[model samples]
Each structure stands twice: as C-alpha cells, then as structure tokens.
Target: MTAIFRTERLTLVFLVLTITAICGLPLLLLFKIGLTAEGSLNIAPLLEALQSRSVLRALWHSLESSALSALFATILGTALALVIGLTNVRAKGLLVFLILLPMMIPPHVTAIAWIQALGPASPVLRWLSIAPELGSDHPLYSREGLVLLLTLQHSPLVFLLVRAALRSFPRELSDAARVSGSGATRMLVKITLPLLSPALMAGFALAFVAALGNFGINALIGIPARYTTLPVLVWRRLASFGPDVLPNVAIISVILALVALVAIVIQTVLQKRMRSALVGLPQAPLDIALGKHRLPVEALLWLFVASVLLLPAASLLATSLVKTYGLDLSLETLTLSNFAEVLWRQSVTLRAFANSTGIATLAALVIAGLSILLGYFLVSRKAGQRLMAGIAGSQAEIAFAVPGLVMSIAFILAFIRPLPIVNISLYGTLWIILIAYVSCFVAVGLKPVVAAFLQMDMSLEDAARVSGAGFGRRIRKIFAPLVAPAAASGGILVFLTAYNEVTVSALLWSTGNETIGTTIFNYEDGGYTTLAAAMSVVVVLATIVIMVAMNALTKKVPAGTIPWRS
Candidate 1:
C-alpha cells in the first residue's frame, strides 16, 4: 500500500487535480457565473451584458485595437527579422538583443516612459519645439496611443517568433532559387515568403493575443481616451464595485477568454503547419548582401530601434533626475529627489519592492519544485500519457493565454470565500495573488522542464528503481540533479515575469501589499509622474541585470532551455 501510494497512477492523479484546481476551478466558476443567475439558467444576463452599450464598445475596442496592433507589429517585426536575420549585418547579435529589450520591460513601464517622453513637458518634444501646449491633455492619451504602445510592446514577441522560424529555414531552397537568376528581392518574395507564411501567421496571432490581453497601455491610455477594452473594463468594474460585481466581471472574463482562445487556436494551428513544413538540419542564415542599399537599411533599422528602446530610456532617466516632469534639465533644475523619494524615503515604495520580491521568489521556487513532478508525469510513457498531457497542457495554456485582469477576476470569484479546511478567507490578501501567480506562471516554469525530461536518459532512474529506491529517493538522488538546470531557468523566467506584473496585482494588491508594478501605476494615476519614472527605472535596471546574469549562465545549461538562445 505504501508503494501504491507513490505509484504512477497516484502521481498522475495528483498532477491532474492540481492543474484542475489552479486553472480549472477559476475557469469553471467564471463560466458558471456568466451563464447562470440566481441558481437558474439565464441567457438573458449574458445577452444583456453583451448588448449593453459599454460592453459593446469595449468589445469593439478590444477587437479593433488588437487587430490593428497585430497587423502593424507583424509587418514591422517580420521586416526587421528578415533584414537582420538574413543579411550580413554587422553586430547582429547585439542588434537582436536591443530589439528584444522592449519585451523585457513591463508594458506599464513602457507606457509611463512614452507618456513622459511625449507629454506636454517632454524634453525631446520641447527640444524639437513641438511639445504639446501647456495644460493640454497628453497627446498620447488616446486610442491611437494604445494602438501604438501595444504594437511597440508586443513587436518583440513577433520578432522573436519569426526570427526563430527563420533560423530553421533551409538555405538550399534559396540557393536553388538563386541558381535560377532570382535577385535578392525576387528570392525573398518567391522562396522565403512562401515558406515563412505559417510563421508569419503564428507571429501575428501571438501579437493579437498579447494586445487583446494588454492591461497597461489600456489602463494608462484607454481610460483617459474613453476607450475601454475588455481587460480595462474588468479592472474598472472591480475597482468601482468590488466583489459585488462578480457576475458582471465573470461575463466580461468569459468574453475575454473566448477571444484569447481563438487566438491561441489560430497560433497553434499555424505552428503545427510551420513544423510540418520544415524538417531538416538548420544551416547558416542565408546571407543577402544589400550592396549599395546596405547602409541606408541598417541606419533605418537602428533608428527604429532607438525610438523604441533609447528614447523611452532617456525619458525615464531624465524624468527621474529632474525636480519635476515639466522642468527642463539643467544644472539648476536637475535633482535626484524623486529617486530618493521612491527608492528609500517612501515606506510604500520600500514595502512594494520587498513584497514583490518576496512574492515572486516564492512563486518561482514553488513552481520549480512542482514542475519536476509535473514534467516527469507529463512525459512518462504510460498508457494515458497523451490524454494526461492534453488535459494538463490545455489548462496551463488557457490560464496563461487569458488576460491578467480576467484571471484576477476569476481568482476573486473562486477564492473570495473561506477555505474548506481552514475556514479562512484568502481574498483581499497577498496570498490570493501568490496563488494566482502560481497558476498563471506554472506553464512557463514547466516548459523547460518538460523539454529537459524529453531529452533525458532514463537509464539512471531505471537503475535506481531496480536498486529498491522509492519515488522520493530516485527523484531526490537522480532526477533532481538532472532537471535542476532547466528548472532553475524556468524559475528565473517566472520570477522575472511576476516581479513587475501589474495587471494581475492591480486589483489583487492592497494598501500594505503593493507590488512594484502596481506601485508604479499608482504613482502615475496620482499625478506623481517623476516618482513613477523613478520606480520604473528601478524595475527595468533590475530586470536587465537579471537577464545579463542569466545570459552569463546560459552557457552552462543544456541547450534549447532558453527561448532566446536559439
């Protein structure tokens, strides 16, 4: 019986139940509330919710903005990927790194930086003598701003996906085309574009989902523009009505979830087609010489990168240094008081930093440890491996695919009451947020581990079992060391993602439990732009330092563990 307790069936059951609880219960609760009212079947509520003017507008806004943003980002990102990926550009590695930096910065931070970079008091705009009129609303506080900022924030995701697909591209196809006297442009259009279509579709779908779920740009720009998306609508309902708005929030969440589901399905289909189309050894990138056009193209690419990367950074740095956001930088006006105020002087800021670090760290460690067990069970060659994998994978995918605002609402709906055993409420506390992060990021942490397990040699574990070692012994002594590197990498990913997470914590955080992301958002909403900039600078700098440290350690880990490595 003791041995049976640790059998494979037990492991599988435990994994399935954990996944269901984390992702399933919240989702189930959401649909139930949305599709029911007063313990009776009620399509009227859903129909009424859908028909409401605000809801209709939000739906249109979400769909319209996400579609446009995805289109723009896909075009720009695909172009950049083709140019840098295939061309014999100098410093290609560094250029790719810079292009990807925007993805690392949280969306809210990017919004804040851009707002500061182009507002009425912008140093850049002022220097160009095109700053908006004083006391005028921010030029970026509109629907157009949401579209632009969302595109910029999500373009890197498209770039990464498209570039990865291109890395596996067969050079022979292009070579054969070249033999037919196909020029560079002709080769690109004739051979490369056809093979890259699936990837392009996949990239566009990724960007669409990202933009649809984006809360930062919407919160900062959409609210001011009276442009409400589903994500922003969810946040507003919760803020304005709290828990009493659960039914309405659930209906909104269902709509958001449906949109996310459609995007994921599209992306998954395209990815399958992409994989089926390409199966061969990856070769050197097809080097296309730009000839006389080389310098101009390179300069153009750098200029775009600078606009997205450098301008926002310069804005944040300047804002943090100045006495106030509107003040010009000079020997007389320049000061670091905002930095001091946010970094050390304010108890809220200090507590936010500590709380965010603690919560993110806890979530990372818990997910890492669980991922080993989950990954092992997922990859086991058992009778029901495929079924188990499908169930677990879908749950993880759905949890991550939905917007943070929607997920936060689900958490509130599911956990607002006291626990069954302890009889203690988890709502209105950091514990709820912690639980949400675990559910939200479990997929991220498990990805590398599952990959690692797929490639691991099972002979060592088989030998350990033959030596009478139990599941605990084998895992602790054998699999632990083998899977540690992948687990560690995934943990870092979860930590980085959850640290500056604003959308999930926006509604979940309270006065004493503010996260770094929510703190920055709060400062901005309170008209403390400089203070917001200071905190954002801190978050971005820390994120970069962590990424650098990871880069240094990537060489030691197994290949293919890091997404950016390939």
Candidate 2:
C-alpha cells in the first residue's frame, strides 16, 4: 500500500511540474513583465504603456482582420460542408482528402506558394499575358490578400467541423420538410441552417481565434502591405532596440491572451449547446440524389478540388525544377540542381532539418506519454480529478487562442533571467524549443486520447483492481494496449504539427538552432526560390511518408483492441 501510494504521488508531482513548466511558466513571465516597472521589476509603467495609441490601433486592426477572416471562412465553409456532406457526392473520400491537403502543407509554405503563383513573373500570369508589376502595385500584399489566404487555408477547418455535425444529422427531419412541400432553398434556410447554427458558431469562433493568432500569413502578406496586426506588431516590438520595449511587448501579449480567453469561452458555450441539441436525434444516413444536375455538380466539385489541391502543388513542383521563374519547362532546365543546392550547397538547411526532426520527435514522445497518463488519471483516479479536468480543459482553450509568437515571447520573458536555484539557462537550448513545442501541442495530443479514454469501459480496470492488480500493472496490461491506436494518432498529429510549425519556431530560433521552417524562410529571403521550393517538397514528402507509416501500423493492430474501434 505504501509503495502504491508513493508511486502515485511521484507520478502526480512529475505531471504537475511538467504542465506548469510548459503552460503556466510562460504566463507567469508575462504577468511579471506587465507588473514590473520600466527598466526594472516594477509594474506601474507597464499599465500606462498598455493604453498607448499605437497599441490600440494594432489591437483594432487585429480584431478587424480576425473577424473578417472568420466570417468569410464560416460562410464559405458551411457551403462546402453542405455540398459534400448533405448531398450524395461521388468520390466523397477523395474530395474530403483534397479539402484536408491544405492543412498538411504548413501555412508559411502555402503563403510562399501563393506568392509564386500570383506574382508578376509567375508562369500562370505570364502565360495569360496578364502579369502585373511585381512591387507595391500588386494587391497580393494587402489586408485583402491576407484575408483571402487565411480564408482559403482555414475554411477547411470549419468545413470539417460542420461536415461532421452534418453527417450525424437527422435526415428524417429534412424528409418530413420535403413532404410538406418545402422548396429546396426554403428547406435549407428554414430547417437545415437552424440546425447547423450552433456548429457554425463554434467553427466561426475557432476560425476567429486562429486568424487572430496567425503570424506566418500576416508576416508574409500583411507586413509588406504596412498592415500591422497584433502578432506582427508584437514581433516588431520585441526586435526593436529600446530599454523599455520588453515590458511593452509583454503588455501587448497579455491583452491578446485576454481576447483569446474570451473567444474560447464563447466557443465552449456554443459547443455544449450544439452537443445538447444533437442529443436523442436519430441520425439517418443521408443520400441526396443530384438527379439531372449530377454531371455539372461533379464537374464543379472536380474543378474546386483541382484548383485548391493540385494547382499550387503543381506550380511549386514546376518552380522547383525550372532554372528560373518565367523560364519555359524543358528537359535541360529540369534538373535536381535546386535540391542539391538545398541539401549540400547550404549546410544550414541540412542542419535545420536535423534539428527540427530531433526536437519534434522528442517533443512528440514526451507529450504523448504525458497525455496518456493524464487521460488515465482523469478516467481512473479519484483524487484531483476535478483539478485535472480543469487544467486539461484550460490548456486546450489557451492552446487554440495563444499564437506561437505570443507564447515564444512569453517564454523569453520568463526564462531568460538567471534562476540560480534551478541552475540552468533555458535560452538558446534545444530543451527550451522542445518545451515550447510540447506546451503548444500538448492539448492536441490530449484530445484524441481523452476521447478514446471516454469511450473505454471502466469495468475492465475495475475488474483488475478487484483482482488486487496494482495501478502500474493494470495500466501496463490493460489501458496501454487498449489505447495504443489513439496514442499513435495523437502522437502522429503532434509530430506533424511540430514538424511543419513555423510561427513559434521562428520567434525562438537562434543561429545555433534552426528548423526546416526557418531554413525555408532564410532561403526565400535570400531570393533562393528554387532551394526553398525543394525544401518545401521535402517537407511534404516526409509528412506523407510518416502518415502512411502510421496508417499501416494502425492497420496491423487487431480490431477492437484499441479503444478507438469501440
């Protein structure tokens, strides 16, 4: 009994510290900065700086862009969900994959690809003879362009959420409405739209938070256009030379965090309502026939798929192979020189690849183990369960709202100073970056495991306990085997996200440590488009291979062995 209690206590302590270090420490640093004095550890000046005019303007711009992007994504995403989910669509699986492709490619990569496709010397525009001037005259760098890119990239998230809701929809209600002589448009507007409202709101809230926190797209598009969103402004403040700049930056980050908290609260409320309303509703499978419009509908769907999925990727491939942007494609021009340059000519790219892979892999392993333990504790343990739930829930909400840049800044503020007791320096180390990745992505790892845990029958564990099986033994024998698939799914998600992540990685990067994201950024900045494209291709290929491997491993597991199957 003493041994079991000691083991449980030790596990709890480790988890608590890990959670605090990753999530709480950064926030504490931000608070310290906010309350501290200018040029010293004092708080009054920080409050005064919060009310500055430039800060207010930046906040307003951030809000405007976020709201616009969210609104656009919601409407467009709902339309896409209706088309794919409510209707009988041939090649539904392929269409769904197409929609998810944008997520697989990092946001920075998407921005760069878009710039290549829409630039003056781009092959598509040059071929059409509609190329505009390459500089300020082009509208691609404006707020409108940022909104467009964000909408395109993030709408898929809304689409997936709404589509899932729609898939579980009660088709009988729609059938009854049709029997009552309701017209297509009227039925959609009156019945379908109302039922989907909660989901729509939740999706919009998520999109809004994501847009508010987005740094990559804003940096690529908005910064050039002189549009200073909050994240960009925060970076600028951090990079600028001034004795008082650090505190001001901290103040701004706190404000952004507050806004994110509000957005999360609203999203939580909406999701709860959605779930409640959907309860007890019979989910009949929908198979809406296109009838006479099938051919045209299929054509439009294919066109959308091609435009969104294939065109940009194809453009990237072409640009990577060609000698120059506008050069015509030929056997002579298409060589592997760019790839060679990226891999061999520049040692930084290769080093960054190694750093990124190592850090991401380590972070994924740590976070996966933590998530599984957390899930187990929440499901099985009696003591501290409410605290555990609260902590896990808060982490998820904050992870969604706090942009990578904000978190990085918070980490710098928190850990740069000397903490003699700990006897360690966090800045510039791979450990710091790993911790940042784990903090930002731990929630992602937790969600799938928690879902799997919830579906599991506790009776198995109860039986084990009744048989006098200790906690560790029961977990090793029963829970671990049952939850392996979910853990793999979560770990793979964490690995992929950390692998392609750029926003936080960019902020925390140093000369000693670079990730693939920063490497691509450097190449793009140096006007090495071919090299950047090659690196981008490498990222995409690596992601696909990892996903394939994970899928195969999951396949080998026996059915119902994993809680996901149940």
Candidate 3:
C-alpha cells in the first residue's frame, strides 16, 4: 500500500512536469517575451508593431480573409450537414467520409493540389481546352483565391461539428411540428435553424480561428499575390531577418494568438447562451423524407464532392506524370522521371520521408502512452488524481486551440536557449520538432482514451483492487487492455495529423531535420512543380491508406473515436 501511494504521487508529479514543460512553459515564455522588453514589463514593442504599416496591413488581411472564408465555410458546411445528416442520403457513410477527407489532408498538400488543378498548365483544364493562356497569372494567386482554398480546407471542420450536433437534434419536436401540419421548409426555417444556431456559431468561430492561423495556403498563394496575413508575415520576418528580429515576430505571434483565444471564448459564451435558451429531451435525429427531391439533392451533393475532391486529385496526378511544368499532358510529355527524382534521386526527399515517418511514429507512441496514464486520472474518483488531470487537460486544450504557427513560435521562444540543468540546446534539432508535435497533438491523442475511460465499466478495476492489486498493477493488467483499442486509434490519429503537417514544424525544422511537409512546400516554392506534385500524390495516397486502416477499427473503439467513421 505504501509503495502504491508513493508511486501514484510520483506519477502525478511527472505528469505535471512533463505537460508544463512541453505545453505550458512555451506559451508562457512567448507571452513573457512579447509583453516585456529586456526582462521588464513593457508594451512599447507591441505598440510599435501595431503601428507599423506592414504589421497593420497583415493584421487586417488576416482578419478579412479569415472572416470571409469562415462565413462561406459555415454556409457550405451547414448546408451539407443539414442535407446529409437529416435526409436519407445515399452512401451516407461515404459522403461523410469524403466531406471529412479534406480536413484530414494537410492544408499545404491541399494548396499544392489546388494550385496544380487551377494553374495555366492544368492538365484537366487544358484537356478541356479551358486552360488559361501561358504567362497569365494563376487564378489562385490572390486574396480571393486564398480565401477560396481556406474555405475548402476548413469547411470540413464545420461540417464535422454541425453534423455531430445534428445527430443529437431533437426529433420529437420535428415530429410534433409535422403533426401540427408544419411544412418542411417552414419548420426547418423556424425551429431547426433556431435550435442549430449554437452549432452554426461554433462552426463559424472554429473556421475563423483555423483560417487566421493558416500558414500554407496563406504563404503559397498569398505570397505570389502580395496578400500578407499575420502568420505569413511572421514566417517571412523570421525567415528573412533570422532570430535577430525575434522580438518583433513574437509580438506579431502574440497578436495572432490573442485573436484565436478571443474567438474561442466568444464561441463558448455564445454556444452556452444558445444552448441554455433551448431545452429538449434527447432523441434520435430527424430523417425527413425528401420524396421527389431526394435524387436531385443526392446528385447535387455528389457533384459538389467530386468537384472538390476529384478535380484537384486528377490535376495533381496529371502534373506529376508530366515531364515539366507548363507542358500539356501528352504521350511525349508524360514521364515517370518526376516521381523517380523525388522518390529516389533527391537525397533530401528520401531523408525527409524517413525523418517524418520516424518523428510521427515516436510522437504517436509517446502521446498514446501519456494518454493512457492521464486518462486514468481524468476519470479517477480521488481529488488529487483529478486535479492533476485537470491541469494537464487544460494545458493541452489551450495548446491545441491556438494555431500551430503560434505554438511553433512559443516553442521557438521556449527552446532557443539551452536547458537549465542539461545545458544543451534543442532549438535547431529534430528533438524540438518532436517535442512540439507531442504538445500540439496531446489533446488529439487523449480524447479517444478519455472517451473509452468514460465508457469503461469500473467493476473490473474494483475487482482488481479487491484482489490487492496496486494502482499500477490494476492499470497495467485491467484498464490498459480495455482501452488499448481507443489508445491505438488515438495514436493513429496523431500520426496521420503530424505525418505531413507543416505548421508546427515550419519554423522548427533545420537543415538536416526537414519534414515531409516542409520538403514538399520547398519543392513548390522553388519552382519544382512536378516534383512537388509527385510527392503530394504520394502523401495523399498514404493518408488514404492510413485512414482506411483506422476505419477498419470502427467496431472495436468507442462510437466517436474515429471521426470519419462516426
């Protein structure tokens, strides 16, 4: 008993220290540096940054693009959720999966795919004889184009949230409305929309924050368009001026972080108020009979899905097969050399693939292990255990809620200096990127385990305890087995998310530590369009394969453990 108690206390301390070091300390250091000058409290730098024309311009651009993109995404996502979630759509599972597919794909890959799809030399467009003339500006290289891609990238996020909300919608009220002779259109407009307002607001806020911190689309498209947003501005500043301008960059990051935090708070308040205004007994969601309109609606939905998914994919594949950019796809022009170059010839590509695979694997395993331990305390009856869990959970949530770029900046500030006791720098090493991945995705990996723990029967643990099993013994022998599937699912989720993600690793990657995402981005940025296309095609296929594997585990884990599956 004494040993068990000592072990528990030590575990609690370790959890607290680990989470604080990786998640809490970085953001705290970021705020400290942003709000102070030479270790003294000062707002002068922040004020000057706000007053700078370039900073102000970037800020406005960020807000404008985010707002517009979010607004459009909310409309699109909500519409899809309503049609698919409520009505009897054909292949409902497939539709939901496709809708969520874009969200799973890294934004930079989406950007690259879309860039190829719409460029002057777009194979699809050219084959259709609608390609823009050579030397014409690519249509997507402007503020509007940035918003369009951002909208497409984030709409799936909104779709997921709204669809979940729809699943919990009160069917009894809708039935009553129908019994009262309310038409579908009128009831949908009056009752359903009113009740779904909270979700709509929540979706908009989520989309807004996502767009505000978006780096890939903003950088890839906006740079050529000369439309600078805060995230891009920070990257450009740091990349161009080096760490000598860390203070200015930190201030800009703080601004971006504050905006994201404010959006979250606003969403929470609005969702709560709207939720409080309505009350209903839980029931199955509505399944309205579309009757004659069903076929056309399904056709429209499929058309929309194909336009978004297939067009870019076809363009990407076509681009990769071509021998060079700006060449039409033909028997003479089509070649496998681009894929060969990226897959085998380019040493950087091979190294990046290995680095990303290794880092993502390690991060996944570490997060999965931590999730199991932390999730146990999250559901523990003891106050001390729960307290530790709460602290760790809140930090993870805040880390995840902010933009990845913001988190990257926080990490930069936190790790640029050597550790206190170890006296070693992690700033330019892959270690920093790995640590950042664990911190950023902790919430992602913990969620499923927490869900599993919530659903678990406590009798097993009680029986183990009655048998004189220690806490560690009980967890290892009993709880661990029960939640292994959920933990695995969570780990897979983390791997998929971090595998090709550029945001968190964008600033952290050094010469030898190039991640797959950074490598692809570099290829595209450096005018190696065919090479980028080939790598992106590979990434997309790999992502689909992993997602399919997770999909196979749908029956083993909790219902919502797999987002696309649920």
In TM-score terms, which candidate is top? 3
lDDT of 3 by residue, 229-256 (tens): 9999999889999989887899999999
Using TM-score as the yardstick, the better of models 2 and 3 is 3
Q: What is the lDDT of candidate 1?
A: 0.86
Q: lDDT score, residue 264, model 1?
A: 83
RMSD of each: 2.0, 3.3, 1.3
lDDT (tens digit, per residue) of candidate 2 on 308-380: 7666677677788888765645687788888888788788888898899999989889877887788887665
Q: Model 1: which ten-residue window has the lowest total lDDT?
A: 1-10
Residue-level lDDT of model 1, residues 293-329, one tens digit each, is: 8899889988988888888788888888888778877
Residue 12 lDDT, candidate 1, scale 0-100:
71
Relative to the unseen true structure, what is the C-alpha lDDT of residue 308 in candidate 2, on a scale of 0 to 100?
A: 74
What C-alpha lDDT, on a 0 to 100 scale, does residue 518 get in candidate 1?
Answer: 93
**Which regions of candidate 2 deviate over 4 angstroms?**
35-53, 133-136, 242-244, 269-276, 279-284, 381-383, 548-550, 553-566
The candidates, ranked best first by lDDT, are 3, 1, 2
Steric clash pairs (candidate 3): none
lDDT of each: 0.86, 0.77, 0.92
